[model samples]
Target: MLVALAIRDVVLIERLDLVFGPGLSVLTGETGAGKSILLDSLGLALGVRAESGLVRAGQSQASVTAAFQPPPAHPTYALLLEHGLEAEEEIVLRRVVQADGRSRAFVNDQPVGVSLLRRLGALLVEVQGQHDQVGLADPASHAGLLDAFGGFEADRAAVALAHRDWRAAERALEAARAAIAEAQRDEDWLRHAVGELGTLAPEEGEEEALAERRQGLQQGEKRAEAVAGALSELTPRDRRGGGNPAAALRNAARALERMPPPNDSIQPALILLGTAQDALAEAETLLARLVQEAAPDPRALESTEERLFALRAAARKHAVAVTSLPELLERLKERLSALDAGSGQVVALEAAARAGRAAYVAAAGRLTERRAAAGASLDAALSAELVPLKLDRARVTVALTPRPEAAWGPDGQDRVEFLVSTNPGQTPGPLARIASGGELSRLMLALKVVLARGSPVPTLVFDEVDSGIGGATAAAVGERLAAVAARVQVLVVTHSPQVAARGAQHYQVAKSVTGERAETSVTALLPAARREEIARMLAGERVTDAARAAADELLAALT
Candidate 1:
């Protein structure tokens, strides 16, 4: 509830301090007593749009501070914590508007944006005037209000949970469908690639090993060729060389033996020829053995080269390194496996999505039924309240419009609105569109009285709630205000004596001219002053004995 309001240099209000309590408090004075100025000051502190004209003449700026002490569980504390502001037992909202039309906002003495101050102010107090009612006027809040009145917290939570599950399952279904669609687009390629890689069956390091073996075989082949060439040179390929060096040497030695039976020189030559023949034979045998040892199998070399090329070709085709072929092959095979099994998985997810949606629909349908019952109850409750406030001809209807499937939300599928018909045969329409300003204020009063158990705002301010009515009608407004005050704080700026007489606390807003300046002042009225004020309201600008007596009776009746 608003504990204090401090205003300085604001239009007619030079300086004023007012303390409020947790019951219906009335402010009463003659016309132009600056009662509206007090509300304007409160509005300024509540983060309303600031204007330079609000500043008093010759004052550089105007400032208003509103202090509130809300309940421990009030949502305002959560709002404060969310904004990284201090959340103490007391919250002070201050606004300072410079003469140049600039303004600053503060909460708990910490600087904050005007927007945040406005939001916090909304949570702390709701100002309902002849022309404006905060929470009650907004359609978006109507559904939540109905739900609160209906005590559907548990039902709403269940519906919300079911909604989330449905959405999650649907999202999963979409992802799986997209995956399967993508996989099908490449199914042919996947199968062919898997088959080709499986056939090659390349090992991790086979490429390097094959290349090393091919090189060794090529070197051995070169060494074998050189050895064979040497053996050919020792045996002459032409007949001029006597078919082989050893054969030619043997023939020469035999010829020397025949001619040298008695010649000593021919004997020495034959001995030299025999020695050369034996040396040539030994050379041929050594060369032949080296050739055999160095020879490489042609088929082995060819096979190594073919295997190396095949592995490299597959790497290029697949855009992977030769060493990565084994890993790539396993990955492709897994993709094919998933493709084959994805249909069953997709079918399972579809069933899950269907079940989730069905659950949500069932929960939402139950909530809808309960809301219908609650709405009927609310209609009866509000109707009972309107008649005593001089709106007996007015009828309130709690309209529940069904929403489409796509538009369904956690609150269920109904759009709740409070509709009214001011006359018997009039078609019921939206509250704001159907009722006059005075009627609207009274209707809003009845609403507050009905939803008193559900409204979270700790303080409610009504400006001229009895603007166009008087006598018993005015008294009825006062009675409802007091009733609401029983549960929360209420403040009213009124001219009706009946309404003023109902206040537990009374203040008289008056203007006084000092020198050339006119300033507004508010004074808390005692019992004697309260009677005089109510009497003054009853008999304008006069102090009559009868009015005073009537005021006494009025106060007495309520007490």
Candidate 2:
């Protein structure tokens, strides 16, 4: 509820402060008394569009602040939290408009964008009037209001849950389809590559092992070749060649034996040659053993080279290191396996999605039925309120239109609008479009009286709801306003004495001229002052004795 309002340099209102309480409060004054200026000031504080002309003369700027004390669970607090603003026991919304028409907004003294302030203001208070019916005028709020009145929380929750499930299932199906499509595009390539890799069957660390073995074999081959060359030179293939030292020594000994016996010099030469021949044979044997021990298997080296080359070629073809080939092979195999299974997976997910959508449709269908029933009840309730408010020819309807399938949402796929026809045989139209100023205000009052229990805003301000009506009709408007105020705070600007008399709290708006400057002032009326003010409203500029008696009777009836 709005707790207080402070205005400074706003049109005729200069430095005015007024405190308010919860209940039906009426502001009454004569024509040209600046009553509308108070509502304008309040609208400025609520983040309405500001005009330079609203600033007082000779003032550079005008500022208005409105304080509200909503409950902890109020949606305004939630909105503040969403905007990274903090609110304690009180939420103060302040707006300042420059003489150039520029404006700034603040909430709880924290600077904020005017849009956010406007949204918060909407959640805090709803202003219904001849031309400023905030919540009622907007068709977007109709569905929510209907849902609130219908009390379809459980059904709405079911629909929301089903919607989430359906969307999840759809997403899962899409992912599976994409995966299968990509795999199918690569199916032939994958199969051929898998076959090629399976044939190669590369192992981790096989390259390094083959390389080490090749190096050892290469060193052995070199040593064996060097040994074979040395052995061939030491023992030629032909025995007749003089290069064979052992053969030459044996022939020399045979020649020496043929010489005359007892030739000691030749005998010494033979002995020495025999010793040389023995050493030569022993060296040949040693060389043969060394060749046998160092010789490498050429077939084994060739096989190793072939295997290593095959592995490296496969690595290059696959664009991966030899060590990673094993993991890559496994991954490709898994993808191929998934390709074989993806069709069934897609079918299952499609079924799940269909089931989910079916569930949502069922829940939403139930919610629609309930809302229709509630709409009928609402139409009846508002009908009861219209006649006494002097709208006997008016007909109100709760129109529910089916939304397109593509536009379905968790709120259950129906568009709710309040339509009104002010006269018989006239097609019902939107409340704002069909009703005139006075008719619209009274219609809004009737609707509000019915929707008070479901309204989220804590305060409702009506500007001249008693316009174009008097006597019992004005009294009826006041009674309805009081009934609504019982559920939420209400403030009505009125000139009807019947409406003014119904207020639990009254304020008189009067303009005073001081030193060529006219300023608006608001004063909270005590019991005596309130009686005089209502009497003045009844008598118009003069409070006659009869008007005073009528005011007393009006006040006496309240007790």
Candidate 3:
């Protein structure tokens, strides 16, 4: 509910601070007592369009502040959370209008846009009047109002969940289709590549091993022929073996031994020949091993070189190191498999999609039924309220249009709008098109009275809703307003004493002059003062004893 409103240098109101309370609160005074000015100031503070003319004479700027107290579970709390703002018990909305016709808005002392303030204001307080008939004129609020009236939060939630499920399924289908299309685009390339890699059958480290072997052989090939040549020079090959020099010397020693018992010079020759034979045998053994090792087949070297070159080129083509060639081949093979075998997978996914969509539609259909039922109840309730408000000829209806094709929305694809017929023989049309200013206010009141049990907004204000009402009909409007206030806070600006008496708190808006400046002032009137004010509303500028007594009696009846 609105707790306080402060205005400074705003038109007739030079400086004013008005505190409000719960239940029906009525503001009453004589004609030109500045009631309209007060509501206008409130609207400006709530982010209404600003005008320089609203500024007080000789003032540079005009400012207004409105404070509201919302319930703990109010939707405004969630809205604040969504926008990264804090939510507390009290939210203060302030607006500053400059003489240049520019304005600034603030909520909780944080700078905000006027549109945002207006949106938040709507959830906190609903203002209905001749100019702003938001409550009845807007069809967007009809479905929500019905849901609130019927306590269908769970149903609404189910619709939301179904919507989420449907969207997720749709995303999955799209992703699968995208994958299939990409695979088809590369089908031919994948098949040929898969065949080539399979034939090559590359092992994890095969490229490096092949390259190393090929390099060792190439280097060994260069040296092999030279080594053979060197061996030929050391022991030249001929048809008759080239006899070892030391071995022949040893044979001469054998002959010397046969000669037996020689002199000292012969003994020295024999020793030298024996040493030469031993050296030749060792040399022969080493040369035999070296010849065997350097005799690698030239054909084997060529084969290894070819294999290594193929592996390296493939690695470069795939943008991978020789060592990563195996992994790259495996990935390409997998892509081929997907393309070849995807028909079955696609069929399965299509089936699953059908099931998911069917489930969603089923859930949405159930929710639609409940919403339709809720709309009916709201229509009946509002219709029941019309007779008492002197709108017996008016017809109230909730129009529900279902679009199965577009029905996959967060709120079940049903477009809910309010329709009305203001008089007999008139066809019902959209509320905004059919209801005139006075009719709109009364219809809004009727709908509100139906949903007044626990509305989202904590405060409700009607600016001259009794504009076309008088006498008994005015009293009935007062009774309904009072009834709504019992559940939430209501502030009504009226010239009817019947309505003023219905308020638990009565305020008087009057024009007073001080210090050469004429200004508007607001005062919270006590019982006696309230009676005098009510009497002024009842009779005229002159207050009579009978009128005051009648106001008191009306008050007595309200209690």
Best by lDDT: 1
- CA lDDT scores, all candidates in order: 0.90, 0.89, 0.82
Comparing 1 and 3 on TM-score, the stronger one: 3
Encode model 3's per-residue lDDT on 1-559: one tens digit a residue. Answer: 8999999999899899999989999988777878889888988877778999999999999999999888778888888788788887888999999999999999899998899888888887888887777654677776677777778778778778877877777777777777778878988877777777677777887876887898898888777777776556556355444554544665798888877454566888778788777777676666677778888896999889878888777777777887887787788877766667777777777787787778777877777788789888877888889998889999898788887675557766678787899989999998767888777888888888887753577888898878777889899999999888988899998878888889889899889878988888999998888878877787786888888888888888878
* Clashing residue pairs found in predicted model 1: none
Q: What TM-score should be assigned to candidate 2?
A: 0.75
RMSD of each: 9.8, 8.8, 7.7
Weakest 10 consecutive residues of candidate 1 by summed lDDT: 254-263
After superposition, the stretches of candidate 3 with alpha carbons farther than 4 Å from their true spots are 188-342, 513-517
Local accuracy of candidate 1 as per-residue lDDT tens digits, 241-349: 6677777787777776677346786777877887887888899999999988877888999999999999999999999999999999998887777689889989999
- Decide which is better by TM-score, 1 or 2: 2
TM-score of each: 0.73, 0.75, 0.74
**CA shift at 139, candidate 2, in angstroms?**
2.2
* The 10-residue segment with the lowest total lDDT in model 3: 236-245
Task: Give me candidate 3's TM-score against the actual structure.
Answer: 0.74
Residue 272 Cα positional deviation in candidate 1, in Å, after optimal superposition: 52
What are the clash counts of all predictions, listed in order? 0, 0, 0
